[model samples]
Target: MEFSWLNWLYTAIAQVITWIHQAYSTFITPSSGLNWVLTIVTLTVLMRILIFPLFLKQMRSSKKMQELAPKVQELRKRYKDDKQRLNQEVMALYQGAGANPLGGCLPILAQFPIFISMFTVLNAIADPKRVSVFGMPADVVASAREAHIFSAGISDHFFSTQSVTSKIIIGFFVATSSLTTFLTVRQSVTRSIEQMPDNPMAQQQKILMYISPLFAFFSLNFPLGLILYWVTTNLWTLGQQHWYYSRHPMPKFDERGRLIPVEPKPGLLAKLRKSEPAPAEEPPPAKPEPKVVRNQPTRQPRSKRTGSKKS
Candidate 1:
């Protein structure tokens, strides 16, 4: 039987999830709900770690975009009346600077497939009737199907789960996930504005910031396990951005759209330099007298030379 590349990808992700699940099951508890949740969270961490290089690239691209904002605005103003020309020039500028306006989206877009696969795998595992795919063993699938969190099966959804406890838990996860997503997007937009107060993307970002939280309503139908994964990932993004910005802050801009130069916090080297006393200035050394060589040939007297010339 032939398998597509998508099957291969699913199998790979399934292996990871299975490994994490097994490890957690062994160390924590064979059937503990918390273990399964931890497995999901750990899976998220591992996924984030694996994509860290992409995240770094995204950060670099975002920084470039921020730096290019002023130039972009200049181009906007220069060709305000000629939209087509302005777009051409802007594209040229971005190309010249090697800046991709949408480069930061690559990482997020890349994760979508993995997220979907994971969700599929979890949903399949939750439903015993569903045939197992992605090279997952039937026994493992059966075991996963039985896994419960807070007396609620991991596959339980707000609409599908019959228990009030499961519904409440799922609701909590959905709410937190959506809230974090909103905050993360909002923070990103705010930073973008600070980097370029008049950034044209600001309005779009505003729309996203408000619309993002509404995803909780959509997530209501998703399995609890998937919700947990999403919430965990969103929280991770929140912390990651916070830590990243602390070290590499965006350029701050005022209401007038002028770049505000923030005073940099003292680094270790700066602190050390400040702590150490300045070295005392050394006095200038006295100039050494020119030594006359004792046996050096002397010039003949001018008068003797004149007499010799006369003779």
Candidate 2:
């Protein structure tokens, strides 16, 4: 290939892979299988860390949207059949509430390029034509290529092998990836519904949630590396969803279509009330009185009585 921009991109990705290999070699034992396993795990962790701030922003934006859903639906109902008015009302509502429906999506959209780059790097590293690292031979490289983070024989069919084992491995990965994606999408939609107002819009969202996963399943079969990426992303999303929902329970909505803070449960309040009252503050102890000398007063009294008797 000519040394074009694309070629440089590939070279840069290869360099990343090489750097990962070197990093693992230094910190991890030189065991053949262990090295590759650590590489994948380490890469996943690094990516997640890099995107942590975005993940947090996504979570906050999602919570804001959920809090705004009831008001949004009210606006939709108020502007029924008037598309322009409906959008205007929606935008106004978002603005007044200091929330944006599109903001939650920005972080996810931003991750696409990085995801593509990582996918390219992983695919390049697994290519049979790529050079082996650290004086490793072609056979060792081929063996490493054959091994997957999940299964050793999984790459056979996709890598052009015709063995029955290859078919089994490929089938497993495809099925596993699809299944994880489905579950992830299902959980997300369910959470949305739980947070949504009871209305036609909620029903529409529910339908889309179900439909989107089917689309995602068919679209993820380009490369085993991409499949891995999808699986990891889905798994990370699932964990994040669980953490978010648990920590931030859905807010209660009032008749005015505004979110209200959920009051502590009465049972919890009763328990809190039952706890012992704070101890009454004790008064500080009084200081003891000093001893008095009565002999000086007795002498003065005796001297005055003697002077009176003499007069």
**Candidate whose TM-score is highest:** 1
- Model-by-model lDDT, in order? 0.79, 0.62
Q: Lowest-lDDT window of 10 residues in candidate 1?
A: 1-10
Per-residue lDDT value at 203 in model 1: 90
- 236-287 in candidate 2: lDDT tens per residue? 7777767666667778778887778875434445668878597899999988
Q: How many backbone clashes does candidate 1 have?
A: 0
In candidate 1, the residue pairs with backbone N, CA or C atoms under 3 Å apart (3 or more residues apart, or in different chains) clash, namely none
Which window of 10 residues has the lowest lDDT sum in candidate 2? 149-158
Candidate 1: which stretches are off by over 4 Å?
1-5, 130-133, 252-311
Candidate 1 accuracy as lDDT: 0.79
Error of 2 at 13 (Å): 4.3
Residue pairs in candidate 2 whose N, alpha carbon or C atoms collide under 3 angstroms: none
